[model samples]
Target: MSDEPLSIDSTSNEYLINADELSTVQYINSTSQDKVLVDIGFYTATKKDLECLLNSEMFLNDSVMNAYIRILKAQPSINEREDGYAYLETTYNANMICGDTITSLRNKEEGNFRLYRTSTYLNNDMVFFPINIKDCHWYLVVINGRKGVVQVLDSKGTATRRPQLHQLVIH
Candidate 1:
């Protein structure tokens, strides 16, 4: 992608833009790789973050998935649900969980990643987890507490998300 400024389509009503957010969007498009582009509560996106968005071949990173999750949590449909929705970011340490023994990890001895805090997703009816496996693909795991359902949505359709599912079961 060229260093051309990112252009917003004025006709799209899907975005909820304010002066500050819009400025960040514009800056990310034109800024150098070293510059920080977006920083919104608990997540930061640098110019390097734009690679996933600009290049179709690149894997979507944690910043982008978390950013999208943040936006999803803000929507009316999500909030209007009877039990509400919560989201876990991409860096929730699914890789570590996939390893042989999570006994030590589950005891909270693992360094505190934000996902360790239950308050973020504990009380919600549905929790959305965006998990990136081996830096190759991302899958969205939706746990519907009210309905007693665990759904995994994967674009590739062949990823066996068994380890992540097993961890969630005991979590």
Candidate 2:
């Protein structure tokens, strides 16, 4: 948050320094509603570190999103960052079967939701469906074709998901 000389802790083993990605950012706070970032100092970080530091709003290019893709692809078990979820959805929309199918669906009455239907439904051994609801959100719906059970996974507990569950289907 400081605009002065930048500093980095040399003791942290989780972070590795890469001089190329180390750079400063500056901007003008034209709005009175929210406190804006006027400047940020430089600090050395690896590609992964830079990706972690960058937020959804700072996802200004493919490099940042690609970094996240590498992380998700490298390890699917990890809970994606909220910003990572944005990029995850983007890549998922482009490459995943659910992206090509009907992701936005309506109830029997008159409503719209994210409980999507995918081509992989009941066709593949494993399927992952992503859903985000208002107020609270679930990350993915894991359907185990072999087990014949559909499970919904979420890092954050849902308050409104119970109602949406009925409209959701694994196949």
Candidate 3:
């Protein structure tokens, strides 16, 4: 796709921002009920405009994911746990390599929690991330550092094209 700048809160930036590293952050939702936000704020589309997409079903390209992420950032009660903490998709992951130079990213609106791949990302309280194949489905995996083990949690049920979602985690 296009390597256009990342935009969140109506502001665009040159590169991606790591949501995991951010200590404090804010979010903004598009209140225009009739229009749908496109990838990285490409264009505001009307529901009728996206009718042919998503198997000819009218859909919000990636805005629903954006809203879910906003909830994760705006309300800790959604993901933060008293017993264990978790991470979500980050803005930096927006450009994650998919097949060749292409990225699986569809939204640059806000809040992708994919942590930086470094020892710093693996805190004493956390664990892992790796690739694995299971039942003909390859998982975008993580090694839970805190638990000292590798694991995969497919949030969207089917471990297919859209398997690597960051909405829910079941420990």
Candidate 4:
């Protein structure tokens, strides 16, 4: 992938400003003269042009789309409680090596309420009765030895659930 930023022509459309030229002109005007006169042409992109630009090879690709999807999925669902409390939870990998808990919390007006992992069992044989609250939702994430955010549930009701396991061959 090219590291260079995308460029758009701003000559024909009056609403568009050439950022590079504007910056250069602004710098020169600021340093040289008390009053600066400038005539700049602006460019406007139509909806069809914008769509075509977005779908172009420079913009549309696996890496770009994947990044967009990741950003979109990263947004968490917000829930409001009747007791003037709001809850937010997002799944994170439980790092067995680091012994870190996959936890989440809400930034409340009073204070933050955090939920952390108490313990973890390998191979999905252990039964977990972490907590049960009607007002709060549960977020479960599965991870490997390498800590990474994998599949996650947005929200789960107050019910007992089991962990899922997948076998993989590591070279």
Candidate 5:
């Protein structure tokens, strides 16, 4: 509801790098793609991935988005908030839900790989899915689990995938 920034790291930049992390960011920027800049949980950011954050024109990459989600999930304030919020990784929404049709997403075969089930999130008042659509755009799919409402917050107002996204969220 608020545009207020989350101080997950320290920097106000989308890259979310603090003064301490500037050196690491610089190293990653200077090095080749093979270099591992930051490893936050399952997501890894390399030189190529860091570019997405450093360069605002570039679309936000899955690794960067997921890494930030992981960081947000780890924040004490987010976890302690009255409105319990849960976060699903970019992989979950992009690959598992959005990538497949509602029919396939409903299939029980992929249940074992569901990250949401294994994640350490509190009760889902608001479930956030930071999605990378077709690797060209990034938007948020916020599910109000308590209120049974699904909201799409896309800056560009791309409604092409709304129907599919709704089906995926429900099923």
Candidate 6:
């Protein structure tokens, strides 16, 4: 958590050597917190690098969030799925169907679970489309169109490698 800022030598400055009439300020920090190292540099950043930075937790601050909201408002809506699925018109074709799982939540209400298996053709497309599954609600399947399989289970939950696709069948 040390905020010590390092200074760059004014004599060895590259921009000064080129006689560009520019002022450059540089800072360097070497520290580790929670097994994560934070290194930040200010300069000209490329679009791809900026995108990577946006996805990082460090960019979740108020200033970054406000900037992102402004940019999103200016951009067109990228969502193109008709069924309200995020990835309806992409190259991947996916379908959502009824599953064979019957599970009860902690509330003791019996509920039916539907499974939307990913097709080989749309495996890569899944990256762009994510299925939103709340605790108890209708699962929206996008990319293609059609339900796949079903699983039956008790209220108790189980964890799987891919929780979205696999239902932990509680006996």
TM-score for each prediction?
A: 0.64, 0.36, 0.37, 0.20, 0.68, 0.20
- Count clashing residue pairs per candidate: 0, 0, 17, 3, 0, 14
lDDT, candidate 3, 44-74, per-residue tens:
4433333223222233333344444445556
Candidate 1 per-residue lDDT, tens place, 28-96, comes to 776787676666677777778766775556777877666666666667786556565555534544445
User: Each candidate's lDDT (Cα)?
Assistant: 0.65, 0.39, 0.37, 0.29, 0.62, 0.29
Worst 10 residues of 6 by lDDT: 89-98
Q: Which stretches of candidate 5 lie over 4 Å from their true place?
A: 1-25, 101-108, 111-122, 158-164
Looking at model 6, residue 170 earns an lDDT score of 21
Superposed by TM-score, candidate 2 places the C-alpha of residue 14 at a distance from the truth, in angstroms, of 9.6
Residue pairs clashing in model 4 are 13-42, 13-43, 13-44
Candidate achieving the largest lDDT: 1
Query: Candidate 4: where are CA atoms >4 Å away?
Result: 1-7, 12-59, 78-171
Candidate 3 TM-score, true structure as reference:
0.37
> Candidate 5: worst 10 consecutive residues by lDDT?
1-10
Off by over 4 Å in 6: 1-75, 81-143, 146-161, 168-171
> Number of clashes in model 4?
3
lDDT of 6 at 99: 24
How well is each residue in 1-171 modelled by candidate 6, as lDDT tens digits? 233433334576443322342221221123221222222222223222233332322232322223443444344453333333322211111112222322223233332222133343244232232222332322322323323323322233343223544432122
Candidate 4's error at 95, in angstroms? 28
lDDT of 5 by residue, 75-163 (tens): 87764457665555455555556665535645685565455543432355776666666557767777777678778888888644564
